[model samples]
Target: MIDNGDDSLIFAPENGKTAEKVQEEYWKVLIVDDEPDVHSTTKLVLEDFSFEDKGLKFISAYSAKEAMEILNNQKDIAVILLDVVMESNSAGLQLAKIIRNEMGNRFSRIILRTGQPGEAPEKKVIAEYDINDYKNKAELTSQQLYTSMFSALRSYRDLKIINKNSEGLKQIINSTANLFQRQNVEQLAQGVLTQVVSILGLENSYYVSTSGFTAAQTSDSDFRIIAATGRFTKCIGTKVEDCTPIPADIVPYLQEAISKEKSGFIDTHYVGYFPTMKDKIHLLFIEDCSKDLGPEIENLLTIFNHNAGIAFDNVILNKEIHDTQIDIIYHLGEVVENRSKETAYHVKRVSEYTYTLAREMGFSEEESQLFKMASPMHDIGKIGIADSILLKPERLDHDELNIMRTHTEIGYNMLKSSSRPLLQTSAVIARDHHEYWDGSGYPRGLKGEDIHPAARIVCLADVYDALGSKRVYKEAWKEEDVLTFVRENRGKMFDPKVVDALFTAYERISRIKERFKDPE
Candidate 1:
């Protein structure tokens, strides 16, 4: 793919003179004239002239109609040397019009050449058609023929480069559209890969991941195939480490490709390396369509490989920044739990239960994650309470309980002003988690549907964990007793809708407790 700002077609400098050998086979040129000598002489004079850095192969046509048939069929032909009086006076001129206007071939350059000066006037003919040059056969000596081809070839090359760049730019713009649609790592990766394959017209791609080392150091040793397209699924889970039976020279070459984050093309195969783990690089091998590995295809492979590397890197950097934010929210909730030793794992258990319940309720992924992370911070205001009140072994008296009730206001105050989603959700949960479903609880005594659904969901998770576990002030209730309390409180203290979902997911909740069970 071409870079956006600079529309330059870069042919790699490393291949040097040998690069010409790769491109020499693809360029096509057509000649249309009645005289056989014109064909023999022209091919002899400029037979070695290579345009667009590729040597041309000539295809001859005796009549104007024959030239049109050849031009319509040969899509990659870059230039045409057309004789004006072939079969008719304006045959070549009419053919140029069809090539430009009818076929819509904006890239192939057309040059008009005539043996008879009287057949068509140069100025009128040149001004009328989309032809690049008008030349007299007698006047076009060996040197002049070379000059005509050189001029036509340069124009054809520039137009093709511009067309390719436009296509690549459109792909890049479309690739970023899915940024707002998905939030998790796997979904995001698929979105990026879908854009990449569509943009490049690739048949398939694969993803690999690894851990334990820095990206550059573990480039060869760490990669393990994690996900793959259907075409390459059989190779999923394969490790890239161990050069062993593989040739030593090929192994080191691949390893170096990973370390520099470079892409390489060998024959019909292409290798794209992406940093998957801090220490690992993933190699995606795409099967070639043409099957014959040529130089032009090799350059195209380089373009895709380079683009995939940048795209993959951007996704990883974004994932890291996002995870860092969730980490801050998680530990902040942990600080609230550290207040009372009996509550050390309270926030963790509540978060797990909340996520499981939201999943059971068929909530959107964004909603479920937001609830899980935000629910744990429900009692964050407890950080402001006195140790004597927070850790008391006896139940609070009336006046002391009134003071304890202020924690809701304190929790809401701590999070209410933030614009971030996690913080905003935290404020909502803090304020309404203590409110009752039947309009009985405080601080605003929000009733029924007045409270946010996020707050209602957290209320169930928080209450369930609170009743089942032993706190500093009470003994752990038996499982049956806890279930009875939740069932009895359904519409009065908890949202009936949430209570129903909780009952449906009881076994999953039991499993969650067992998974994150406190060591005490």
Candidate 2:
């Protein structure tokens, strides 16, 4: 430990103290003074001084202008010992002011040294220059010089550490914001990995997060390749099984951490290790082949492990919610199937058919998907009808048929007024599907121009599905027969424009039929 008045320069101290060792561990210090004796004297005092196991390396500059040259070229200079009365009476003071106020050398500690105390008063010089220390050259004994150098060096080291951490924190915050903006889990995972690698200063890497379906009973882990920053041959979507096995070097550590659900850091650069996540521990892998990582990279890995796990949980929850909604819709479609002898595949086929027709009609992809989902609910009102009327093989009497016709009104009443896309389209179909272009049908009896386009489109899908499918009351018709029936009814039972659109979509309709073919 070296002491300089109120300041202490105690470096933790490496195994040995030497100028080479100090230069290797700490930022270089430059001394600017006019006197040749001061440079030699200062070096002798600090030759053995070590701060935090690091000794200080010193460079000497004769004047303020010389110091600026050194400052301009040597970015590693962390601190400077300056004299206030070099060249001109106040040149050192002016240089100190310029270094701080103009050059923006905030990180380098500046100590102003002067021998002619009368030329510039201590109080005035201290106020004018943003120097860390003010000292009379004559008063700075060997011990005092050693102590001042150590204290200034320590402050410089601490400031550098603080700045690096601040930059890392900023990177983390920006990456977290990006993660939040992502709509898919892959994107979120990518953001997390990118931030982590950057903060740790890793060269290039990839991240994988693994989790299970349930908290306790997950099968083979679900792996998500969240982020990749380096030039790896594998793509982001590549599964764990597709990649080469974990390198023999990292496999054991990874397996142990994964089994215990504990986080760990590895030193291998060629292959990265992460535990397989079953129900709990979400695994992450990073392939960083760079040679620069040591304890700093390990520190980052520890920080990232927990953050990434939480992110994976959020992604899984979102996926589960999306899948649950689809399952509920599927079961609801099944309920419609129970109302008639139509299989659940019938609803699927009609949705596909509707999507194809909408696509052929030049609708946007979003509208086509909406039509696909809504088309399944076109017959949803049949759920309200009795099996006796729905399954009757014989022709109904006029009154029985009238009650059956009320199914359209029932379907409309059940779905109308709801704001959901599926319900809204179903409502339109239920209300106007039976209406003729000539205004000779039931419900609202809307005419051609007045009918909602959604209803008109579904009318074609419903009729085509009905004609092509075998039902309790009617056998399935041949493709040619169905086309003839549709052509015969065009402009009478169906909208003429819609019939024209349907004819254009015959190829698409056939493809939908082939794609969603029934198992039975």
Best by lDDT: 1
Across residues 189-261, which tens digit of lDDT does each residue of candidate 2 receive? 5665555555545322233222111011123553433445544324345544433433445445445555766
lDDT of each: 0.70, 0.67
Give the root-mean-square deviation of each candidate in angstroms: 10.2, 8.1
Clashing pairs in 2: 11-51, 11-52, 12-52, 12-53, 13-53, 14-53, 190-226
lDDT against true structure, model 1: 0.70
Question: What are the TM-scores, per candidate, against the unseen true structure?
Answer: 0.66, 0.63
Clashes of each: 4, 7
Best TM-score among the predictions, by candidate number: 1
- Candidate 1 per-residue C-alpha lDDT over 1-520 given as tens digits, one digit per residue, 9 for 90 to 100: 1112343222122222112223535467788987766665556555567764678777889998998889888887888888888778888888888888999888888888887878788888877788888877655555556777888888876786666556555545455545334554445445544444454452112222211111122243565444445444443445434322223344454566666777655454344566553544655544342344344434554565455555556666777887897788778888877766556677888988888888888898788988998887888887888888878888888887877888888999999999989889999898889999998888899999998888888888998888888787787899899899999999999999899889999998998888878777
Model 2 ranges with Cα > 4 A deviation: 1-25, 30-50, 53-77, 83-105, 115-120, 127-129, 166-188, 202-242, 269-280, 287-303, 338-343, 346-513
